[model samples]
Target: MRVMTKSALRLLAVPLAVLGLLFGTAAPASAHAALVGSDPAQGSVVKTAPAQVRLTFSEGVLLSRDAIRVLGPDGERAETGDANDAGRGNTTAAVALRPGLGNGTYTVAWKAVSADSHPVAGAFTFSIGAPSKTSVALPTQEVGGGAVGTLYDIARYAAYLGFALLIGAAFFIGVCWPDGARTRPMRRLVATGWATMVAATILLLMLRAPYANGGTLGDAFDLGGVRDVLDTRPGAALLSRLLLLAAGAVFIAVLFGSWAKREDPVERQDLAWGLAIGGTVVSVGLAATWAMAEHASVGIQASVAMPVDIVHLLAMAVWLGGLTALLAALWGGHRVERATVRRFSRIAFGAVVTLVVTGVYQSWRQLGSWDALVSTGYGQLLLVKVGLVILLVELAWLSRRWTARLGETAVRGRAAAVAQPVAAGRKGAGGGGGDASERAGQLARQEAALAKERARKERDGDAERTGLRKSVLAEVAVAVVVLAVTTLLTGTQPGRAAEEGAAQQASAPVSEVPEPLDVRIPFDTGGTDGKGEAEVTMDPGGIAENELHLLVTAPDGRAFDVPEVQISFTLKSKKIGPIPVTLGKVDTGHWSAANVQIPVPGEWTIAVTVRTSDIDQVTRTKVVKIGS
Candidate 1:
């Protein structure tokens, strides 16, 4: 068998690329990715001193998020101190209980944007000095809060398994099964696996949210919500995945077509081979979606991440998906074609080598430093994945040795020689000593038949050797399982290990860390074209001061301030709350919203209509959420 032949290596192109992607950067599901579990045990109570309120989640919660807040029994913010995020599995936030938290009720409300951009939230109350937090604990709300994260983990695992298995079945159909073995039973598994993968893809999209704030089933199908999602990165990635899936449907057509024309080797190769590569390319495209959605939006970063992402997807396809192909070749029960075995060996060698080098580079960029490897969940999971990869390499080495043994066996013809000598002995014994001279002559004539038998026996033995090789490939198939399991583990925090590592490195801040804060708009300046912000001071206790800083542009486009302008706040709605609408005298096309006491936190629509000749620039509905 020619090694690295075109046919054998062509299937390899996608797999090599896929392996690169797997080792290159963490997949979307792994590496500080999603929310998994939460703390406070999600509605448990205790009598002991908790020191600080805590929340545990599935994935690392960004330390920059600001949505976790604790409310005291008296309906006051019980912010004794700041919070800290572990950035691994069980993140802890410290909000000191009101120094004298009276023995009563409390609520811990939290909202978070997961690494997948889905919003996860929940409220848990723990009573002080009591064994019970709530007389009525709500379990359903807790589930609804964490459902996105829960479903995400499930979808990822399902996709990976389906990907590896469906491709494996295709390989089996083409390479292994006897001409008669393509039965209804085998067909069912293939169809089911593909269907599962497609279903998971759809489920993942329905679960993925934009900017977190939490999403729901209604949001999943809402026309406006869908539009907002498509406007974001995650949405675009889903669209790309859908396109790739459509391309994979092409594989389905090719697959059945080939099965129907198995006798035509040309047509079989055309359909089977084409579908394998095409389906693989489309399937691997899912990995690239992460880049499009996350890093690629930045200019320079996009250039680097996009190519790297492509390499990453291709490498994964080669390693995980190729495992299926190689395993089938190994087990396919045919007189194992030496050519096929050699082809797989050659491709595997090159792919593993590429994976190691690129993997190191990708790790350097993502993990940042040696400290990261031990101090971050992303780093630890990567280490575990690498360990599994090394184990796979060792398995490959063992299989390669077996391959070489056969290579030597084929060259030496030792089996034929063994049978030839034994058959010659039997024929010699058959000729009797009574007719000694005649016996010698007869044995010579039988030598040709004995030689022929030896060749036939050696050929039969080849079948057995091929079967043994197939078993080795079966062993190789286990690597895919290890990889899929690793994918799920990647999404979880290596919190315990990372914390220990942080302490060991003396990098834990001298001061206890603060709880994460969700930064909003970076508190940017409002419209900086000399549009001065007037000071509108209002006391919730009922008094108000109106100071208008009106800067009006002159006819020549110059600016001047109308120091003395009338400003007042008016009640907009008589129905709900103290909904205030700000009003100001329109002085030469400029207006201001003066004294306003939005006594409540709901929708405050401030109507500012700047009247000008033939034009009224009216910001009549400026809705804002006050106090939150």
Candidate 2:
């Protein structure tokens, strides 16, 4: 009991250290669903309304009945039919447009489930007969941001954690800790894991709607939103997971209790077979639910990828879960058994090999190119995870060495224990003919020496156990980071998706390419007869918030110094009031405003006032087209 308490304290310390590192530099949540290209490409101007709206993603997507919505100038839905999957890999979704759909500008708001069952939603605008002065409001809330998104991600992380604990720990208790089956702590841990998963799944289900629509926390329980989620693949996948968990609970109880604690060999053998088959079926089913809703269910060679993914998840559960069980149950007691430790070492080794093999294949499939490891956010994160895994392997190696040492010590101690009793018996027999007092004295000395030797061996055993405990704790600390990274990785866009998107952008025709919103206007003021050019560049030159760069140059094209620079924006067609923008001077002799808000699509008149001298100031107005 003392050993258990001490080891639990040591185990608790590892995760606490890791939690500090995890939250200190946590990455933002990013979904895997990436927009590839759409018909009437984003921010495009078409002479006529197209027959349909088509959206393509990097991987396959499952759409809700209300998946693709086209809103015309009046903010009325223009889609005529349900959105359907199209193109190869079911990666494209298309919806018919109403005939003669008049548009100043049309917004396409869409919702879909990625191959990995994460729900994604986004909105874009396209125009008919040149860009319109007024367009339907783009869906600013397509993805839940801020608090709701945070909560949704938290739910996902919890689910992953719970699944690992429940599944892995149960496997350990059933396979390696039959003696511990009746322990209260072991049962309670398993129960806690199961309950956590249940709660997390429910939380996720509730958050699905708000996450898809970019709504507030209040919208989490909105019945309509929840209904919408249920209509989608991700929702169904979540539902299936719930069903599996519920069913598996019964078998989990059996495996951890009746089958594990049975004393009858024949009955135990039969129950073992039952548990093996029943548990395997349940595990594979649960894994399939994960695979069906994630990236492995879509993309290249999805058929092969799905099964590989199942294997990967199962391997993770076994390794991580088994480690937890070994630490909390096997090593928690007064004595750490050599046989149990050695058996687990073998099991852990196999799990590691499986993790490596499957991980490599998944990485290749998701990343596609070598440069992606450094080029994409997801790849960089994956690299970090891989580095931590490498560290974990080294820690495992250290722990393995300790296990070997423990095994050696146990063997030598047993031999010494056996030899001591035989030598003491010989001494007692030889002393029968000696003086009573002398015989008694000799026996007392032998007993004292034997007790001292036993104490020394006990101390040595405790020291080895302590060393092993520390190594295991360190390994567990690193595993926590690995799990966090994996959770984040699932939420991030695959590197292959990013590469594919870039290729699509690069392949577009020059005429169709978005023109840089870089404008240079030359002006002359009568006061000093000084001439200068004002060059303005707006990155992501659209009606959306943009970065504005204003550079002033003299007639000689040299950097022209201005006493003050003021910039303001107004939508002429919308008759909106001029919104004053403050600019800061940058080292490059340019005035910059990081976020220039252009609320709606129209001809935005950007008025830049530059004071060359206090008395010789001029304002230059440039009419720039901004799209919603």
Residue 560 accuracy (lDDT) in model 1? 41
What's the true lDDT of residue 138 in model 1?
27
Number of the top-ranking candidate, with lDDT as the measure: 2
| lDDT to native, each model | 0.50, 0.74
Q: In candidate 1, where is summed lDDT lowest over 10 consecutive residues? A: 516-525
Candidate 2 clash pair list: 30-491, 115-294, 116-293, 116-294, 116-295, 117-293, 143-214, 144-214
Compose the digit string of candidate 1's lDDT tens values, residues 82-150: 566644443444445555555444566766544343344555565554321223332233322456666
Query: Please, what are the lDDT tens digits per residue for candidate 2 over residues 12-80?
Result: 345435443543543322226677789988877787889999998866776767888998867888999
**TM-score, candidate number 2:** 0.66
For all predicted structures, in order, the TM-scores are 0.47, 0.66
